[model samples]
Target: MLKLTDKQALEFGIQPVHHQMDNGELRFRLTRDTGSSYILTLSAEQSGWQSSHVHLRKREFYIVEQGWIVLALRQSEQLTFRRLGPNDSFMLPPGLPHNVYLSEGSVLHTVKYGSADADWEAAPELDEKLRHETFDGKTFFTR
Candidate 1:
């Protein structure tokens, strides 16, 4: 008989997972259904950041797990802002920009229902927030 751990399964292509960075925040894609869609887990501990931009080929959804964050997204970076909380979530209805700012010790569990490339970029003006940020694309170790 043979068995596989989650990490092992991930490496063997039996499972698909990806982790990313939000300046200093910790975020990941865990337990994905590659045949159709997938889900993501985004964890972060940050402050003083209030904006970002994203280019997604498919719509994306997010569900918060813990802590607090402010989501301000737009089609032209000049639109109105929307805020979210620990028990709150939202969807980016495809081809729009997404900006998520993390409060201290904030963690989010996101569920994406499509297979598309997402181009995520934090505002260049957020250099102040990047200081002491704890994201390394795999795990987070606070400063």
Candidate 2:
């Protein structure tokens, strides 16, 4: 994962802060400080996984630009999964506990609507709650 500073993002004409997550995911904030609205881009390498968490009051929209990703979502004591590829999109409403696994060289454009504070609630033990299987280079999860 490539890490960039705010200055680097400006120099690169991205215009927003750029940073790397602890898991090595890269993010470029395209818009910010707009109160409940933000846009960003995220990139990850194969086998990379985003942390499991939920947004209390934010709705998230994702557009896959390259490669693919698998989303694991938990709802009403049930876990489900979805795989999305290039040009595919998904909108996640508030209160959904989820995590994402990125395929090789995946790039995603995302929009957050509803709260600027993130209201992020992390569920670190979520992985233990899933029943999953991997086949044909992809992983699927279910309760």
Candidate 3:
């Protein structure tokens, strides 16, 4: 079994991130095998204007484990936002623009299946986006 201790994980530089439209937290897990896959968690304390303009080559799956989240999805200009809480599993297909906002103290388990390349676009694009910023504007710099 893969047992990742908090100390080991933090020692490995596991850092909280500040993502678009969030003022909370962001954690990450990445695995590169025959399939390009990763697991990311987002916890939000603010509303989101987040989005994914990149199309996926494979399906993306997400489950809310902590609090709640709102997903903004665009289909041919038909915009929709869905609120999701714990025990919610959303599977998004390729080529769709989607963004998720984590509610207060929210935690999400997100994973992508198969080798997929997707462009990431969180609307309100900030060229000043410094990577490793926490959802709370706390910046954690990395190489």
Q: Give the best candidate by lDDT.
A: 2
- Cα RMSD of predicted structure 3: 10.1
Give the residue spans of candidate 1 off by over 4 A.
1-4, 7-22, 31-45, 48-51, 116-143
Which digits, one per residue and each the tens of the lDDT, describe model 2 over residues 11-126?
Answer: 74445657887867778766455434344545545355677899998888988898788888888867788888999999999999998777667788878778757488887767
1 against 2, candidate with superior TM-score: 2
* Tens digits of per-residue lDDT for model 1, 40-110: 44444445353455545555676766766555555453444455666898877756665665656666666
Better of 2 and 3 by lDDT: 2
Candidate 1 lDDT score relative to the true structure:
0.54
What is the C-alpha lDDT profile of model 3 across 60-120, one tens digit per residue?
7888887777666666756565667788888888767766655567778877765534435
- The CA lDDT of each predicted structure is 0.54, 0.73, 0.57
Could you tell me every candidate's TM-score relative to the true structure? 0.59, 0.75, 0.61
Name the runs in model 2 displaced over 4 angstroms. Answer: 1-15, 37-42, 130-143
In candidate 1, clashing pairs total 0
The true-versus-predicted C-alpha distance at residue 62 of model 3, in Å, is 0.8
